[model samples]
Target chain A: MESVGELGESGVLGRVLARMGEARAAVVGPGDDCAVLRVRGDAVVTTDTMIEGPDFRLAWHDGFELGWKLAATNLSDVAAMGAVPTALTLALAVPHDTPVALLERVAEGLDAACRVLAPGCGVIGGDLGRAPVVTAAVTAIGELEGRAPVLRSGARPGDVVAYAGELGLAGLGLSLLFSEAADADGTAHDRTIAELWARHPEVLAAQLAPAPPIPLGPIAARAGACAMMDVSDSLSIDADRLARASGVRVRLETERLEGAFGAQQGVRVPVDAMLTGGEDHGLLAVFPADVELPVGFAAIGSVHEGDGVRLDAAALEPRGWDPYTVRPPGS
Target chain B: MESVGELGESGVLGRVLARMGEARAAVVGPGDDCAVLRVRGDAVVTTDTMIEGPDFRLAWHDGFELGWKLAATNLSDVAAMGAVPTALTLALAVPHDTPVALLERVAEGLDAACRVLAPGCGVIGGDLGRAPVVTAAVTAIGELEGRAPVLRSGARPGDVVAYAGELGLAGLGLSLLFSEAADADGTAHDRTIAELWARHPEVLAAQLAPAPPIPLGPIAARAGACAMMDVSDSLSIDADRLARASGVRVRLETERLEGAFGAQQGVRVPVDAMLTGGEDHGLLAVFPADVELPVGFAAIGSVHEGDGVRLDAAALEPRGWDPYTVRPPGS
Candidate 1:
């Protein structure tokens, strides 16, 4: 296997770029100093980073899956803004000894995700450098298409809170990976990964390569969503943030959550997991009480004239992953 | 100093965001899923990454300088496309024990660069994560303001080649640091950085925090520049690339180069340094011979009906930094 150092930057870059598809809005694509994009309306931009230790483990994540997750995660943020994603710029750095094939696979995965999740959206520009570990930073751009952005602060007291895409399955998948595929000391390994995947393919796929409903963002906006945000951290944590931002309280009914997300692809997801599972990349939205929920969205709660988040009549603590404070086991 | 791990993600994010200034084009700033920008015309996007060990050493680079360089480099790329920079997104990852104050300084530096280099451009959104070393990836977006982007392949025969901003000073500074402020084994240290900075302030500043003539990009476009690119890797190498892309030959005159950039800011730069120096972040442009050069630009060469690059009829080999192949000493 040829390493990046052996093939050199240009060599690896050429191969990696060859795998990328053209973005519909890109007037000038890669190889130039910058990629020029045609914007129809207001532009929305978001960025996210995934590092080796805290974000993923090479032992469990394939390059394709890593790249897919990177695209999906940032695309979800764009979707949460009720915009159409147009382009992604990636900044990837890895150790000198990293295989060039890994980068090619990553590009393939990124292209695949864009085609499947957000058609016509693609990687437009990026940079490649050397690092101590695999590090990827993705910046996604979206077009609002003449509509007002669905800000988190727009939720009203009489709005119905709804959720779309995966909810707790991702968090459950993460738990399963740590418990079954990791050593006793918490170090991740692939020794049982095949067996684990064979037994629980849905959870593993949900965690490793999420396919968030990207198109539903515009649909929900058109359907009269009052406020929206990507449920990246967790339903409870992100809901609390939206509630505080909107000066309202979010009351999630247990029955609604279970009814909507209890059995995702044959995987039983408990209400607790739905509240606290991270990396779901789903959309949490609020709409007027009179408005109908979008086809892909299910009503899970309601907004009330109060502060913070609640589970029915009980106050729910906002607990989720904090990058600085949360040290992944064995990392 | 309080470490990031102690402050937690949101706590550190709040302090860091407090230091950022507002972007004029921003409709919605940080704290949301994405930053919304009211773009006037076509948007140009670019991304770049800097990682510890390979890109820079903490011993010589203060947090502020590192952040400033990160913004400057990416902004230069946006400028190269004849666009007015609008916003920046930074993805920063650092060790858990890293000081929170350092991150605050980084934000301050980013805000300061946007204000000084490209007013109205500021950090809009970003992500924070944990890594083994300090890693920063910055994506800059610029609005073309309805003008067609100046591309590298637009140069034609009889066009005059020009250069603007710092020429060889940045590369001279890098050489000076490696020779004076680094140990024999190539490990960088700050013990002698103060003395070196005092002796060669211009070069050090050029290398550490280049203020590339970003405004000149739009100026050149308005002045009828046929082709343009930022001189990031070296005049020789980038000139060759422009020539190849344009399907023409670039003939650089030594006397013309000496007359324009021999004594930039009182530093007598050798012709060789101007040819091979990297990280100048200057604009290299080609304009019709009949058009007047932009105020900050000086003609140094001319396009010919041939291929490759030349120096007064002598063939010049293109040479510059390759991140994967070039191992910084002591790193």
Candidate 2:
């Protein structure tokens, strides 16, 4: 296999660019100084970075899965804005010894994710450089299509709090990996990966390559969602954020969460997992009580006149991932 | 000084976001899923990455200069599209033990670059993560304001090729640093950086924080520029790309290059540096022979119905920096 060092920058770049399909809104795509996009309305831009060791383990994540997760995570942010994702710009830097095929797979994954999750959204323009580890940054751009952006601060009292897409399966998948596929020191290995996948395919898929309901973002906005956010760092943590942003209290009902997410894709997900598991990439939205919930969204909570988040009658502490403070299980 | 690990992610983010000012096109700024921008016309997007060892040396570059360079490089891409740069999204990942002040300085520099280089442009949205090295990716967005984008393929046989902003100085600065400030093993040290700056401030400034003629992009477009591109990888390399893209030959006059850029900002630059020096971040544009050159643009060459780039009568070989193939003088 040829490495990036052997193939050189331009050769690797050509292979990566070849895998990228054209975005519908891209007037001029990759190879230019900038990709020109035809904006239908307001433009929404978001950026996210994923680094090896801290963000993902090469032992556990295939290049394709890593790229897919990168695209999915950024695309979820655009969706949370109630916008139609238009394009993505990826900045990828890896060690010189890294395989050129890894980058090609990453590009294929990025292209595949865009095609499957948000059609018409594709890789536009980006730069490739050298880093000590696999460092990928994706900036997603979306169009509001003339509707007002659904902001986290837009929810009010009497608003119905809803959830869409997968909930806790991703977190469960991660837990299973750490427990079954890693050593006591938390060094990840692929010894049990195939077996883990075979036994927990749904959870593994949710964790490795999440397919959030991206189209539902604009749909929720058109259906009159008052506010929305991507649930990345657990439902409880994000709910607390939305509550604080909107200056209201969010009360999540236990029965509703269990009933709606108890058995997702044939996996029994506990209520605790739904509330505390991270990397779900699902949407949490608020709507007026008088309006009907969007097709994919399920009512799980309500906004009230107070502050912070509540599970049943108890105060829910916001806790999940904090990049600076948290380390992976071991190294 | 407090480290990022000590302060945690949110605390570090708060300090960084505090330094960002609002962009004129920003409908919503930081502290959201995405920053929303009011687009006036077609939107231009670009992304660039900078890694610690490969792109810069922390011992030599202050955090502010590093951040400023990051913003400047990406903004040049937007400007090359004949668009008014409006916002930047910065994805920054640093080691856990990095000083919080470094990040603060980085944000301040990003804000200052926008204020000084592009008045209405500002940092809008991005994420912070953890990495083994300091990795930053910036995505810049700009608006065309209804003007047709001046693409690299638009140059005609009779078009005049012009260069704007600093040329050759940045490459000279890099050479100076490698020769003087770095140890025998190419390990950078600040032992003589102050003295070097005192003697060669012009070259150092040009290399460290280039102030490319950003506004000249739209001005040149309005003044009838037929083709435009940001000169990032030396005059010869980028001009060859432009020539090939347009299916025309670009003949650069040695006398014109020396006359216009030989002594820029009180620095004596050689013709070789002007042709082969990289990271100038200047604009190279093509205009109709009959059209008047924009104020900051200097006519340096002309286009002909041929292929590749030429200097006077000889074909010029395209050579500059290739990230993968080239290493610093030593380790």
Candidate 3:
């Protein structure tokens, strides 16, 4: 896995895309030029941004990767919403003396990503200026084929809670990066990421690149996902969110999850990570009890009559990484 | 006009958004705690960020405004795209010893903004860490009514180039604070930011608090705007963008611009700032030759078959403010 703070730059995105599922409105998702969504109308608008050190590391990710990631991250959001992404507006703040080439690469990555993921969406406007660190912001819009949207608040009690994307790879990879940073040697190493990284060379890619389920979000929503949300946070946290929004308790069937997801241990984070670790970009969804979901979803949890989070029999703790409560690497 | 960098936190944003036209999708924008867009789909997504030296003034802006602005800025973008923003993800980097109250205010701002804009969006996911300065990245996802989005490149030649928002107040207000770094007097200007600001308080207000035309973008687009763009950059620069993207040149009628624009200038920057300034957040659009534009738009320019820019009859030589070619401020 790429180190949280010192991860390398290139070749991490592909792996992230390989493991992600598809949403309906999204014609394209991660690893593409841009994540394309089908907007209801002809007009499409989009935006993007990059943060200084926290979003990336100068050591592990390169300028180019950061560029691609920044654009990919925002494009994913638009994709998740089922809008046809048409144009992007970038708000960039960087150090005064940053290398021109680095900025160019970042721009290049943005352009390249748009071309691949969502050809319909083009880079139309960008804001560039000086700052102490490099940061970018992007926002994207898409067309929904004139359908009712999919929302997290729409789930109900007895809804079949399912997931259409990878569970905990990013959380696990991020943890590995932090642990490695704490490791005196600091050489990048993650059993799951190494294997996947070599093949796709993009496993930890999930950690850095953030391959969003651009199309799957709308798809799940349209496929009768009563309630749906992107799992950019802890599974337990997001589940709790869905539960709270739907006014129900979510009883995640640990046994079913164990049966279906234990094989990928490296990617399979600690249950705590699975419950609370963030930034996986997966989707947690609730569906009608009887209707079969679209092709990508795996049912591992069910909604119940309760409050907050629960795993097996016990109420889960809100232990996801928090800025006020958690201590990140190199802080 | 506002500077790209000035304005104490939300002040700059307020300036940019002050004169924007409403979109059919936007339930709220900028002035609200959180901006809302009508969602065509069930789910809405959004993002926001805080820049240290630029978006926030270490000497001027407070932590709460920082947080609020971080969330609001991104939410504004979502509104611009005609999406009802839901859920926010943040990435923050700051010194370990940063005051907890400051962070709390930032969170409070986030919470407040969400409560106002998209209660559903709230503080869903975020990453917190350390850096020399404080910076926050927040992304807001919005849902839009089943309508097509408005794009910056959609304007056609011969379309009346009009705007649904004001221009250059942010730049004007920013000028008051631009030289604060070099001011040897070191007067206690930072202590009372409210009073010792610019002469044209409205102009400065535009810089500090931009009025985004949340509803106007989609409206203008649908109203036969050949093209539509947010006036984050100077009207001139952004207009140039429309021209280049549309494969046409724009003839900005300075007299008409003078009659329509607020903040009457003396000798300098009337035309220059109007044309080349940044952060206005106005809409620059082109419409069919005979079509009537929506309310708030006055014809300030026309799109002709040419390359680059023009002011009246003269060839508008860009002063390096083009999206891809702007020189660093100090340079």
Candidate 4:
């Protein structure tokens, strides 16, 4: 399996959701870009906290980017609950030496992100504490409008598999970050791709501003998908998860996957990269054979009568993100 | 205004919520016992975090007591929301040196507290992180069957102000902590309030196991409370808040207050302590003239048309918890 942290943030999220224990009121838990909470009869709630060194750092990710990521992450939880986000509460623990404007800009990013991703959801309440580490926890509430929340455990066998939202982009962007390059500012620049990461400055933006295939989760559910999951981790690895949970076998057509990804990036991704790379935050669902999938998804696999996932007819290995675990060359 | 931090955790929460920007989905924001989040339909959501140094110290509060406090504080948020808490998610960050037995004992406390206060809620999901601080964040969700959820903004003039929990007990317990008193086992000895606190031991347990008057939020709301708030800080200080927000004057009947308080402690709290001590986490609400309050609440005073909190027809000076700006008496 890929190193959990290396598969990066979204990958870790996907893997964690797979291991989530069942809780009745959970309605919707981690995975699918956000965790939706069924508040009561009319609203949904969600909260996300970002740590300094583990989630982000001033050294690598700027404060504004951190702010945007924090809001996006929390709001995604509301979305996952099938609820329209309505408000956000922020609790901040910041070091004293940090500039005040930085905090303001962080709030600015939160406001801006709300404007873009959740228009009706505004920043409302929160706490401010002084600490050496800068930690921000955003709690969001949403209105479900009488819709059933989609959950990670709803997947089952005989369901047609489908996905929406881009996969591998954020992971590839992060991989590019380790490259050595420079820009006009005499600082190492970021690239959108690993090869260009050192040559340009967009790489950091992609890593910090991960655009989770947000809307697809509900859309897939609405389309009558039986078993569904988010592809925040590598495709093959997540497929294996679906297979295990649903008591079915997941098969992947490597050629079709290569064509789909190759056409987007103008280069052929290593099979393992498509199989083990993480941070996609895309939706992966299964529906009845008659259901029609929305655009942005290519049918690259299917689930059949079996237990767990397979690729081209074999018992596939577990290859998703695992922070405390080790990884192999391909993984 | 009082230095906000002087009120300790609960006081700080009250002050911050007082200034919480207005929003449509607040249903209940901060203060109270718990934050009721209107999630999907009629569900409520609340969250809280417990830190090692400020919230708990291993050298003082034991693992079970710490866990009980953590659960109590988080559950209090749900109660503040006026919701029947249904579940809880805990994200705990601890140092690698922490023993598994300590973790188990903490879980035991979690179980015990839930059995007492929140039978509907249990420790749900959790994350274990390696850190120097034993950090834990619990996001609790509840349900509000069909009540007009209560909030902090409804106080009206001519209302009777009331409270449903002890004041200054935890703060007094904390004071005993800094005093040069301890039994051989490091646990205070037992029995009388003074012995349990000063001479005996179990009194420290009250400070450790602060069972929030969680049931009062909903009860107060049902009692036609004009404006409801929690008394996390000193009575004088929090009363002033209700007064100011309601655009009214608050007059504390010190004699009656001392009478009721002395019956329990056998000690009349110093005027300074009564005005500045915090961390009671009790419910304070304003009731209409026609409403009769439930048991345990005394009509501390009345709210009249005016501005700011008043005491015996005089401007009450603010002095509560404020970590950064507070100076010890005679300092």
Candidate 5:
């Protein structure tokens, strides 16, 4: 089925629709001009697009993984808004030579992602077209359930900075993939690295298919979160963004994150990776100093009356994943 | 700037944010992970994508026109559902070589389109990234306002078929652009074509920057429309889809459509164009037999117990704008 032309656009869409089960939030699903969804109070909408060359490599990721990541990335945005993701719409633009089978795999991956990460959230509608390269735009609709949405600019002085998901593991995994440690001979030194890799397969999964801390968003919101956002870029860069938006200084204790970095034995993880590695899709939030940290969340930093971001009182370089600024290794 | 690379992604986004004034529906607009919107009851969601080569030609359409068409297409979907468009989000994936000014112009066009067609509905959020070609994914959110949504599958036997907005003018204009009538020289005796082009500039505008009858959606629904859809593809093809979905036959009077085609005098508009010309973004509706037609709508056909669409009681071809099946000329 190389090139969806074999099945044609409608055929491919029919197969995709068949794969989708049901969304509880959708009053009416696919086949209509619009998907009618039941909403309470406020509706949350977010959109994210992932392009082939800049966002991923076919050699490193397959259609299933791509589809999962696509859902994760978009759902994470809804989660960051402190809403329950109810429905999703995808617009896929693929090359004329792309396979229909790959799209099915992608659909399966989307279903699997929703099942594991966001149960009851189903893809209700989508648009398919041909492009020179594969690109996907996912629009997620979430309901606030009468709660106020947590904004990035709501953090204040004397707030405790907390995090709920893995930190820098995805970035470290990416580094490992780029490094030559995997190609080494079975020498003692190479064996140490291989053993670490075998023992810590979750690190690889973090990079390939990150299960973001989505549920934590509502928890933090209900717990009186002052400000919140997902850690998509590096911690330092994203922290600086939060600080700039809130007009406060973010001070992180580097020692707190050392535990995650030290999980792998024999192989030393770079401090830069822990500080600036992106694609973690973790929840970073702030709360009042007296507020109790929720389960699965760790107090890592504090907010003070100042500017910029700091790691143990030292200024950290503010750089994160900017598609226009970063180029792929060869390209 | 010649390329978006000059300003970087963030810089471009800042410029775009500056252009968007305010959205009444959005509680939290751009600059956040998700845009929070106010909803009454059921939320209507629709998505559409336009690509460079297949959707438009840079020689004929500019970024502004592309932006307007993009918004028009998505909003029309909302209207077809008998909903009021509330908010919109776009994900633009353009080549790195695309001009930043062009993107700004596109933003302006989006704002202008919203202002003219669906005032008070605004673009609340969007994403920008690099792609091999210029591709845009626009997702529109609408509110049904506590009323039951008009679906395409709701048409019944003995329903009256009505249409609001232009029919084949856009397609005819497209034909004219590709026809020899556009040639500068007045050598041949194609005076009829030249006179038609000189007389009806609105036809070209209808093709390029169509101001669709979006506000009539709620009106038609209040008038007790049973089924509704936006005619994005050829009327014959889309009508057939509606008929098949509803398990009924739509009988369109060629005499009724003749008035639409006759607007372009002296130009022998192809019958095929009238039947199959798409991208007009007109509203087609089915109403109860005794329901009075809306102000802008004219009854053009009738519904009966059958399985396919008919033209003056004759079966029409079951074909329309299927991207996979229809290749652009010369591409």
Candidate 6:
């Protein structure tokens, strides 16, 4: 029951550092003024912010899951750049009354994500602060390993648009959670919700802790990926971003998208979720037209000399999860 | 004035990108999944966070100044490692109702800091989100330039401790501000504080926008510094940190400390502030006894075989700004 205020900053830091083992890229790790890392060739850096209210509901998620999501969100960007994740730096601002045990769980989650998703990558540096709400700011650094970065601007007209990892499962999971909450009345209790959640573990995991295709980034780059990005927002919205950046248009076949969404049993899969559901953390990449598709990638669309994203000859609206417009579920 | 809610996330991001300009180190800047930077050799990475309530007060500091301080706090860490700053990544969480113009000012401040303090170093990437309070998390990347980083643990018993830049000035500035605020009544106005502030421009600048001795970090390393770190908290506190890391005791001379104090005519200088007041962003370094002190650095203490820090043959208490215990002035 002891909170972070009782445990103190140094105590919390000691727990975090203990969870994060030695990093291969780090010459010097935490406790130093700056972490010294070995950077081979170009270094790719990306940063992401997740707030308690807008990004997650603490009632539905624990510190461990939050930590994994934070790492997934940042590492997914590193993977999108066609680089190998080398190191990470985290800045956490939490309420003074937050449980130190919760923070330790968060550290465990971050460490587990790094170990499972991007092996050898570790947290090199971080900061802890007191705040009203829990906020995580993660920066992921990656090594290019002698390959040119697969930028979003490199998509040519004749490129083949492909994706690695689940597309709309996270969105479906979120929808399920929302529906479950809405159906709850005065009689609903934690026990019933737990039973309900137990029935749909896969969908909840996709929403709460996405396993992004981190390793496929380098593989796609080696296979001559023309352009690449992580599908953090809506598939349509992010695809439109790639199209605009590359000065071309992306056209997705409905049948192909349907094929990707095979055997949806309990949850009713919404088509809009597949197109606009964000937080999937999947890789959306464009490869050379003649290049062999990477092992994990499946062709979902194609690029042409036009603007914007289209589906079945119809222009798709670039709408996704806009944090400003939508309130966090249960908030 | 238009608020960030009206502008939306992408609209605000576009404005921020327009202000960032081109970065020398980044092959890809903002508007992408990741920013790719050309890393020469080894990379020095550090991260720091500043929250509105604890780290800073909006009533006392504006967005532009807050931006600069955020950069200074992170860049100073890079300087402690004896590296050349290359790029920075920022993650900002602000209230949705925050003024768009204020965010622009924040961007201006970030740009000005990079232009003035560390030329060629730029903000390569950043993330923005909605939160209850304004928070800035900054991660600075630096190149070691083929020199081994001066770690805090490398100090020897015979090492001479030196400091670059002002000591205890920022804390003094905070004290001045606090006193002025406390003295204000119905009769007291802005004019009275301005009059009080006119007497100590140096101290105010040191607190509001500290120009840390960043260049001195590399210079000290090249000059064979045994250990180095930025004086972020208090002189004694940071010195104690260096001592603990090096497993040695640091002894400071009273006369030498007085000499560093120079002439304090307008305001009475507190000895405790001089020893324990932090936020100075000064460089605390240890060098071989025979090595010539680098330009702009003044010898302050000597390292000896023992534990903890001492002044004039007595143990010095490691008291400084601990964010967990102290509230911002006038909060």
Model 6 lDDT, residue B103, Cα: 79
lDDT (C-alpha) at residue B22 in model 4: 27
Compute DockQ for each candidate against the true complex.
Answer: 0.90, 0.89, 0.13, 0.14, 0.83, 0.89
- For each candidate, report what fraction of the true interface contacts it reproduces: 0.97, 0.96, 0.05, 0.11, 0.91, 0.98
User: Candidate 4: misplaced stretches above 4 Å?
Assistant: A1-48, A75-87, A140-144, A181-203, A265-268, A321-331, B1-46, B181-203, B265-268, B322-331
lDDT of 6 at B93: 84
User: How far off is residue A322 in model 1, in Å?
Assistant: 6.9
Better of 3 and 5 by lDDT: 5
* Candidates 1 and 5 compared by lDDT, better number: 1
* Model 6 CA deviation exceeding 4 Å by range: A182-193, A264-270, A322-331, B182-196, B264-271, B322-331
TM-score of 1: 0.97
lDDT for residue A322 in candidate 4, whole number 0-100 = 36
Cα lDDT of model 5 by residue, B1-331, tens digit: 5688778788888887676656788899898889999998799999988888767655556678888888898889999999999998988888878898888878888888888888889989989998988888999999999999999999999999999887777876665555434233312223354455467666666776777899999889888999999998889988998998899999988887776554543455555666777888989999999999988998888999978888896788865544324432333
TM-score, one value per model: 0.97, 0.97, 0.61, 0.78, 0.91, 0.94
Tens-digit lDDT track for model 3 on A191-310? 344344564333467666656556676577577676666675578777777677678888887777766555443544445556666776666777899979787777887777767767
Give each prediction's root-mean-square deviation over alpha carbons. 2.3, 2.2, 9.5, 11.2, 5.0, 3.2
User: Which of the CAPRI classes, incorrect, acceptable, medium or high, describes model 6?
Assistant: high
Give the clashing residue pairs of candidate 6, or none: B233-B278
Candidate 3, CAPRI quality class derived from DockQ: incorrect
- Residue-level lDDT of model 5, residues A1-331, one tens digit each, is 4568777788888887677667889899998989999998798899989988788766556788888999998888898888989999989888877888888888888888888888889999989988998888999989899999999999899999988787777876665555433233211123334554576667667887889978888888999898999999888988998999999999988787665444533445555666777998888899999999888788888999999988897887787644334432332
lDDT of 2 at A118: 98
Better of 3 and 5 by DockQ: 5
Q: After superposition, how far is residue B256 of candidate 5 from its true place, in Å?
A: 2.4
Q: Is the docking of candidate 2 incorrect, acceptable, medium or high quality?
A: high
